[model samples]
Target chain A: MTRPAPLAAGISAAAAAGRRAPVLHAEALQLRFGAVAALRDVSLSVAENEIHAIIGPNGAGKSSLLNCLSGFYRPQSGRVYFDGEDITQLRPHRRAAAGLGRTFQGIQTYPSMTARENILTGFHNRMRTGVFGALVWWGRVRAEEEAFTAKAEEIIEFLELEELRHAVVGDLSYGLRKRVDLGRAMALEPRILIMDEPMAGMNPEEKGDLARFILDIRDANRIPVVLVEHDMEVVMDISDTVTVLDFGEVIAVGTPREVRENEAVIAAYLGTE
Target chain B: MLPTGVLFETYSAEAGLLKTARARVAVAALVLALLAAPLATGAYLQGVATHMFITLIAVYGLHVTVGMAGQINIAQSAFVGVGAFATARLSEFGLPFFIVVPVAALVTGAVSVVFALPAARVKGFYLALTTFAAQVLFPIIVLGLPTSWLGGLVGLAVEPLTVAGRPMNTPTHMYYFTLALTLIASYAAFNLHRSRFGRALKAVRDNDVAAEVMGIDVLRHKIMAFFVGSMFAGVAGSCMAWVLQFVTVESFTLFTSVWYLGMLIVGGAYSPIGAILGVAFITLVQEGLHELGTAILRSGAQEAGGAIFAATNIALGACILIALIFEPRGLAHRWQVLKTGLQLWPFPHR
Candidate 1:
């Protein structure tokens, strides 16, 4: 398999100096629904191969931020750049084709499909087969399908979901479905993966497993992750950097320890002073 | 699930169409039975079988749109009309059966794309209404054309299908033609369901927003769904023209489209076999009711003719309603249950 092109156009010496270029850059994003502002001038950057957590209390626009980055919600103002290319105007699928992948706040696996099929869908953009090729099922389409199935199996193993690979996703537990969703996103082989509330309803153990997977995604897969998570302990434990949002605005941006000790983040999470 | 005691060591084995030895034998026997049907069957039964195969093809077309891609296509019959009319025109030009069929499919597929474009902007009831407009518009367009083009409401007479300079108009020949085409269509559909293209469409059906975010290009796939569907309809329409040797607006009606949807529901929209089963059940029921209606009229119950005539429609509606309420997944799921039971007979349950 060919390596994915670096998220940034030019992974320069400056980037190689441990000060990597931001793979995804959000600039002063402002989103409004009717008269209500969902996100107000929220800007954050996710660097190469790092877990950048977007954390905040309810209605703080963490999800809105992830939505903008993932190209779901078009912000009223501000631009999103990936690999130095502006992508604010790209549609969700286009952005996905451009190597942006995401998981929904709600699990979005094709319920009737098996876990293997669900994960295989994540490789949608990568496959080169068209309608005729798929119908005929030979040559390029066949080879690519075999390769991708192998890749999907590898991801299933990585997530420890080999047993659940052929199981219908709808019949699986919520936690397993969530893992399947992640595996699907991982199949996209995204340059940067954005997840919405990966551990929202998980038990502590499941949360731990998911957090480890997120870290492995960053460190081992070398893909940057933009995680919108609410659990503070998991956030602080896994995040290389944390950007705190409060009422549609970015209140703090720093390392996990810095954000945890920040006065504003404490106030936002635990009632204002 | 893997059949009771069966295990697959390779991906191909796991993904094979028939799993256990029993399944292979059953499929083989079924194919042999179908192939030898003409030998045992008379002309009337052969015609019924031929019509069933044609409806099976059409219903499978509807399945691709309504079942696989989750698009509601009320214009299915209209697209079929596109094929029928195109075949009428192409056959009029002295094209061979083999050539005319594919050309009809292509023409209908293109027309389907026109109908499908509205799907890029709208869906559900609104999308259904959009295709409904096509359904309303198709017959008018055909009848409005110059007699030289479409023959108006009188319709056009189709030339006999020929292969290699030999007439294929006999019941036996037509049966083989329909069966061969149906087999090819079913094979293509079967492969498509497991292929990347089909999976992408199924993803779109399951959740369009999720499919889009996953980079499936929902609009493109929706268009593709319509194309494949109408292409199937086109092929079916070609077969229909061969069966009737006549093309008329009355043959392709809005009611027929609805009946096709009913067939998909009864058959299990997601399964090709369900399409066949649904077509077989619904067509046989309609024929049975037709005979009943005739018998009622002959027995001096002339007034009951109208009621008996409406029985087919009522029966179709009831079948759809029952399937939706009690077995929304359709007969395919039920078949799976039965197969599982058989596979694990002594074991009782999985």
Candidate 2:
């Protein structure tokens, strides 16, 4: 696909999905680490097919909220409901199994594994073959593995990683590693894809590619995306709703244009600490 | 790694050990050579080759835990000992070696899980220390027990493996027995790494938190790696018991475990073939040095044998240190790089 032009208006994924329903809900989440509060009464809703962007300055609890929502951090008081079920006490892997996939800002792709193998690891939980079955590598396990590899191949093709499919991921450039991380997350077939700084270090060309991929995920896959990005250009172009955070609290929630015009968001971005 | 011209139409064909027509012929030739080893080689060389097969089996276990899964195990020999002793006891009960092998493997796997329980929480040096406890305690428990039960320091003599109601007394018979198990164990280890469990274990080894986010139970995979690795050790131990016709704490030591780690580093930790190559390299070097020391003493080149023997130990240590400094990824990886370079010819291939 050619690089798509920047979106002119805030085209919410809701518009493409043709309906709106809160698929992921975080209500009154309050998290504290000893004395300092990382998040205080942070509440957010990710509607179906919406690209919800969480923007904040440093120490503004953007990651803290994502952690709580993804079940990495438990809130002191409150719950996270996913698809109408309370998942507050569930573990991170359980939450992931429940269809919440995420990419780490630090790039958590398996370094020693190949680009294709790293993507295949994402489908690990989906396979029913146990260790004994795998050791045997009989018909059932062999079929399961072939099926998973076929799926990984699709992701590899989608990310244009055909040439680098056998290359060790640790040897890949930072931009490529981030892209592989996105592919692995995508392989999880998540109901809600959460990404932290998906374009932190990419050049403009790579950023455009990533932007198009994110749009494809929203438009083609129709999965809701909750992204924490510092790149304002990306936030304004793709995100349907921009939730601005300041001092561990939500300051504004609106369309990108309205968020840009909010007095409180402007003050937090360019005003006193 | 594949030759540049080779390609596959299916995942099964792609993942196959022998992908090309030439590879198939080469593997068949290798199999014929192995099967004909007893006929061509002298008794001593055949014995050495058989021992190599057994060591390769245990090293494959180490490859899984320390190499692939990145879980350090310093008590591999203890698991081997568990198998050996289990086999010695089972054989006395009039069980066949076939039944004895799997039972010993299961017992050893269970024993390894006892030490591996801490692996769920601890990693790296701490995990090694936990396994170290198993290494230290294995001998103590064997020697500390009653002389009649575990045979104490006197050790327990295992009956020679019997085939079709006949005792397998000859070294050639032992060689065939071991080669068969080694092939099966190697096949199992190879398949384990390519399976879903292998992917889960590798994911945990690489970035466990990310693995968890990918919906893998990190603790379960780590424990499974230990269970499977130790079971390989068990099968090796059973073969060892039948070969030596004995079980003794002196045979399985911390040094043996350390040497297994060294062999893994020397060969290449990633592939099962690497594990075999590592065992071959280390065993040949040690045996070759030992023969040289004995020959020098016999030729009266050295006033005393003790000095040359000590030097041999130093030289062995030096070889491992040099290998780490130079080919850190192991011989198998260096071989791949060489092949890839040859395929590229004069041009750089990264």
Candidate 3:
């Protein structure tokens, strides 16, 4: 408990169990904003313990794909399946409750709350104590709160945010806020984490820190990751499988190296202004 | 903000309402003062203190709904009116004040849920307008009823508050009664602030999208805030009924709703102490203005009392303006700054 256990244990266990079922599968998604098509015939799958990266240009529908996957945007025609159960039409909160966790493109935390409180808020679905228990603050509420705070503390320690745990999120630096946002998502203990531009607007050092955190979230925690990213270096380095999109269409999908060397991906990147 | 240089090694210690030993001592002293107040003060002062406590209860509700939950509820006084009428009707059925008060609170809470239902779709100005409709429509509905139903604007007289066959006739007796209810209400509010539900409400308030993704049911929390807030307002309204000995449609006006909100803003909408301080400060200002107007009339200023009575409204407006401009966070933030400065005196505060 002092340090993160090797997620390889979980990965090996998953492999030994011979589970090939995709943790998440999106099929032929078609999303349109009025007359403009944002995603057309886009399909992808994230396996257990895999970090799947979706990379593309500004108008390449990377965000739209993430939105569809997380149930924030309903695809005009598509099916999203989590654990092989169709969830294409579920509401955002319902999806989250069904083990879909996400961090926004813009770092979002409870602004007036402390980092600890913000992280604790992420455990909303976990806590079962009701209004009467909360108002009374008796044995049950205190116990649940203590248990959850300990859980939240583990995440804080994992992220090395001990000093900033009590700091108000509004006053924290951007890098710290991003860490807190990730910590919030991690608090859900989701089977799959969907991050939109997790390293956006970060300096190289901050980006490195975030990239390591993302990898830790995937490898150390053994959680499947679905990321929409712009930083190609981090994407190629950490991503297990890469799906490249261009003009709302999938151009290539393979291992990171395969996608990196794909003639179509090269043309898509070079062809953009 | 705990005392400077303090360190809490446990979550309970850090999250405790009285985090520092100094705060515990201060609260103990305040409770002692509150207990002794009835004996020390005259009837007029006791009456004023009773009013302050009642207003604090209502403001605390507003603080939860508007301040923490980030739902603007202008119809809080309407909820209060609902409570008062509920109390009046229940007393007519020969129920005791203790039973009648809680019934009133529950009734008003249920009524607030009706108003809050539409909040699932509307937000900000639109939501405020929705609650405003409650404020505007409440009196009309109350007055439109037959005279036998809700007194038809003439109002209904509340039966005397009695507990265990003892009539609470004197202001001192009623003060103790109000004090007990206030203590219970404030304790619940304090506990609620550190509770999981309270944190969830804040999360929804800060960013509903993030809250939803974090698995918080935003609409449920918003409506819960309204329910709890109106429940507190209901308690306050029952207290007001006892204080006034009557319930009237005219008493729960839009002006009354505005007054409650102004008190919240002046006190700081985020804390119970802020609500209490806000109600106390505004009540004192109104009384002082009235006293000033009386003195002016006694000193041969013809009709100055009427003008001064009108000037009290102007002064209330000025108080809100000044608080908003100078300390938008309210007196609670000012109190915090002062306390922090004092705690770290002789050293540079970070």
Model 3 alpha-carbon drift over 4 Å, by segment: A1-19, B4-9, B303-306
lDDT of each: 0.86, 0.86, 0.87
- Model 2 / residue B15 / CA error / Å: 0.7
Instruction: List runs of model 1 lying over 4 Å from the truth.
Output: A1-18, B293-310
Q: C-alpha displacement of B134 in model 2, angstroms? A: 0.8
Top of the candidates by DockQ: 2
Interface RMSD, in order shown: 1.1, 0.8, 1.0
Q: List the residue pairs that clash in candidate 2.
A: none
Residue range A33-109, candidate 2, lDDT tens digits: 99998887777778889999999999999999988988788899877888878899999889888999999997789
| lDDT of model 3 at position A192 | 97
On DockQ, the stronger of 1 and 2 is 2
Q: Which pairs clash inside model 3? A: none
B67-159: candidate 1 lDDT, tens digit per residue? 898899988888888888888889978988878988999999999898789765797889989989989999888888898898898998999
Of all native A–B interface contacts, model 1 reproduces a fraction of 0.73
Docking class of 3: medium
